[model samples]
Target: MTSGPSSAALLLLADGRLPAGGHAHSGGVEAAVVDGGIRDIGDLEEFLRGRLATSGLVTAAFAAATRRSCPANGPVPDGIITELDIELDARTPSPAQRAASRAQGRALLRAGRAAWPGLSCPLSAPHQPVTFGIVAAAAGLSPADAALAVVYGAVSGPASAAVRLLGLNPLAVTALLARLSPDVEATADAATVLSERPPADLPALTGPRLDLLAERHRAAEIRMFAS
Candidate 1:
């Protein structure tokens, strides 16, 4: 039997219209822009590319793995999912970033559960990927689709922030997304590797500079984004 949700379901999860409170967070782009790392559309695009390669890829992998491992009619295995969440948490290394991630995850969970009833979501502290996987599974979406949605969300959220901060053209933003499509797919493929085994078996790779940026951003007296 097939293990994916219908196209409509995938669209719902991927749609920017979903009330997941994603727009409230900038995914760190605002801070980067303010710090001079991103000045214009080009810089924002580059930042997104690097982000998609590292944190973006990792999140997609975990979400995909969770979706694949979760059964349709039962609670997902806590050991596996919690391990993945902790891995993400540990890699983050920034208390601000961790709090921001968990905040978004909890918001998404509350909204998603209400929007789509009969879903099995854990009461444990949710990281973004864990909530994503559970929501995708509940919606009958496939791991691959869930992974793509996550990667797309990660990319777009920051890009949107760039547009507002830098005053970039919306059309340019859309084109940037088009250019990143191949990278997104490639990242999704890399994420799919997680389906082969649980998150614990995966090799360790974390970005330290990003963590520092998150921490620095938090300490700043003036800030537009949460983290």
Candidate 2:
């Protein structure tokens, strides 16, 4: 019999259909599409890549750090998780982005509670990545697994949004995601390594463009996405 942790839980968390309210937000893609920053599959790839390198990295590292802060078989540390939340808030400069993350976090927390009935999250409304980390830990996933999930979602969410916003071919978008897998793995690995740093020392890579896009999306009168 296998004694190691199973990958099924990780897969469940990463699945887009997990009812985490990820569908409502495009991760800034809708605003970018409205702003003419992405017009085709090629532009979408570039945008996803940029996101993977910037906010993606920060999110992955913070998720990994949060996972590390969680104990394997005990109550979650509220103090450490609170510190991580504040650090994540600091890293995310845009108010719209922060609100969007917390909204998703709340949704994910509900899903997490459903999946793991005994799950005890410290924060009522944690950031999305922090919630992801806490849920990942409860599901018996490693920090590296949590990091990979965040980076993958970071790109995949925008990629999926591009399909609806631009009418891009689903096959082409899937192919584009396949092509970016290596970079995603590398980014996740880097994030996992950086997770060893203190909460305040985690990667603070900011995406000013994404922040502006989020702000613009928030103000759009007839927008499809909430963020």
Candidate 3:
């Protein structure tokens, strides 16, 4: 309601180094490597592209919607948030992935609450993207910024993991990320269009291979990333 969040807030949230426990998760890259879905930078490109389109778009939409739902003043409505949570659950088909998202969400909430108490987030256990939107609202950012932040993380997390998992050159990986920025922005814009949609009307984009990898990652006795 007030001036939407500033560009500084957007940068802070999009920062991969932000202490949200995101470094520990690979955004499914670890499982993909274990499953032989990714072997080199070429394969990583494909994986990143698919993730940016599917899970990336879906989560970004939720975050933008959540950002839009927050009131400029007064307590947040828990009922609406509850419905949003359910919508998130409906979109994510994998239990392991769900737990992973909630974990990241909780971590981000902790950081966000400490950083900006003004946002007055209502939930203790939101999906990562949902919490991200609330944090953006608290930071005074717009829905478009929220979408960009979450979508950027969706791709960057895995790209970073690819560095560790595959021992690929970081410079090349970064360049790949730069090349993909246009798609990320496009996806963010598309999500912003649906930010005001009803929860039932939110995007439902599932990645079957990612889901299977998450399940397999959960069962693995020894794993590098959380999900």
Candidate 4:
């Protein structure tokens, strides 16, 4: 039998139905839509493209880095995870965005640890990408697997949101995702390349509009998603 987590584990983790509170988040897509920014699937496709290139790239790298920081079948170094969290916070400029990330991280951590007792995440609350990487390590997944998970979730979350917000056809969104698969694989591989670097060296890509929208979303009177 193989020693590490199987490819099926990747499928399970990447699925949106994992109950990680991801459903309540549009990954900032809702805020954009609320502002009359994204009108339909065409706009959503653009948003997804931009997100994948910017925040998606950076988060994927962080996931890979977090996995590298975690010890595979060994004790994790104290304070290392904390440092990773701080670095991620520096990358996230908005307070609301940070909170949203941590909440999801905590949820994913709970699920990840419970699902795989061998995995140990020292941070009580880490950034989502960091938790993903460390959990990937614990589950015997490679840095590439972590990257795949990160990039996939980054785009998929917003795409799912587009369906609900714009009342767009689900099949069209699925086709859009299918068309973007090659780019997703490329982004994951790029992120995997940065896995061995220190947190400081990881990419610091940002989305100013997404950050602004996050703050707006937090203060809104009525909203469907959490972030």
Candidate 5:
């Protein structure tokens, strides 16, 4: 069996460190929790599963697709990247959520470019998945690996946030990760297949309830998360 990249590097992208500003956004979990939609750990898991099925899956697919399309040692393609960005923008209906994703994407790009030179990242107009895919490619991770990392990051960010907001047990939360590993792997596999195709061929499976909550959360005066 061929060994993949160093575990340390994979951890760097997946560790939730690297200064991506992901901590500031909760992937709509905060709104769900505050509104009583996500009341316990079970609710948190369900919410994250739905997110993975929709935006999370789409984002991973785009990232993996970009990685697949990008040359191993050539300039990143701007056109495809732009297409993914616009797609993400259209999918994210809530203004607040759009702003949040862009803000985080820009931050991730800035940090990624600084850490890995020769990384070509667009300005902050596009959403997070675009920037994330570019950064992952620059980091030398394969498309499948990038897809898995992106999917894991998307789900874990909110899961971590729930730990703080709901005061859930850390051990239990870690255990949840183990249980959800299969789902994450499956999503990544699906994303990789989708990435091979054009964005037009991609399915539009965004969650309306999540969008509604994000809109309502934006109107709130006091909020812990950016979106």
Candidate 6:
């Protein structure tokens, strides 16, 4: 994969402020917090670490793989993107998580189209990481760049929610993220290497608690975050 200085486009995509509808979702942290799985800063740290290890690594891998699937100048093939989407869906067993992913994907697709003309995917709503990979490629980002954005979002999303859900100090939360930097980088590096494999061969590590929390959140009559 081609490498260069971190492009401004990468920053734009990775920024949490991007209007991709991600702010509404907490990456399952809201559900966990409500379920008593996270009550303080220490619990939040462990949750973020677990998330980074499982879904974070898997999403990063798919993002890298998807970026490789889409050529820099050619239109993405329907069959190939579909296969990747299916593979990601299989990895996410929770229906709530699948629905949340598609919702975010649709929002991200709309935002990407505004910034990168001609950016289109076969599916109206692909998985979030798949859309992320496609958009990253459209913005002239490398596979590793895509992986970086995915893994970062994997933990950052939950951390953002934890602050709101648990009333955790923002400074502490930011510091926690700073401390997790090495882990985030390690996860991204591993994902980039795993991206060299076929989509079906990618890792399928999961957190059952995340799945249960997603289901519980979906059923809750009162909720702060979407999932």
Give the whole-model CA lDDT for all candidates, comma-separated: 0.79, 0.91, 0.88, 0.87, 0.80, 0.91
- What clash count does candidate 2 reach? 0
lDDT of 5 by residue, 23-102 (tens): 87888888888889988889988888898898878888877877776776678877887777777777777787788888
Q: lDDT by residue for model 1 over 1-227, one digit each (tens)? A: 12444667777777766777787778777777777988988888888888888888888888888788778677777777777787777667778878888988888788778967876665455887879888888877788888888889989888888888788999999999999999998888787776566566653556665677788888889877777
Q: Which candidate tops TM-score?
A: 2
lDDT of 6 at 44: 92
Arrange candidates, best lDDT first.
2, 6, 3, 4, 5, 1
**Backbone collision count in every prediction?**
0, 0, 2, 0, 0, 0
96-169: candidate 2 lDDT, tens digit per residue: 99999999999999999999887898799999999998998888889999999999999988888888988999
lDDT for model 2, on a 0 to 1 scale? 0.91
True-structure RMSD, every candidate: 2.1, 1.7, 1.9, 1.9, 1.8, 1.4
lDDT: the better of candidates 2 and 4: 2
TM-score for each predicted model, relative to the true structure:
0.92, 0.97, 0.96, 0.95, 0.93, 0.97
Off by over 4 Å in 4: 1-5
Tens digit per residue, CA lDDT, model 6, 141-196 = 88899999899999888899999988899999999999999999899999999998
The candidate with the higher lDDT, 2 or 3, is 2
Model 3 clash tally, residue pairs: 2
Model 1 lDDT on a 0 to 1 scale: 0.79
> How accurate locally is residue 37 in candidate 3, as Cα lDDT from 0 to 100?
87
Q: Would you give me the overall lDDT of model 6?
A: 0.91
Question: Which residue pairs clash within candidate 3?
Answer: 5-140, 5-141
Measured with C-alpha atoms, the lDDT of residue 182 in candidate 2 is: 97
Off by over 4 Å in 1: 1-5
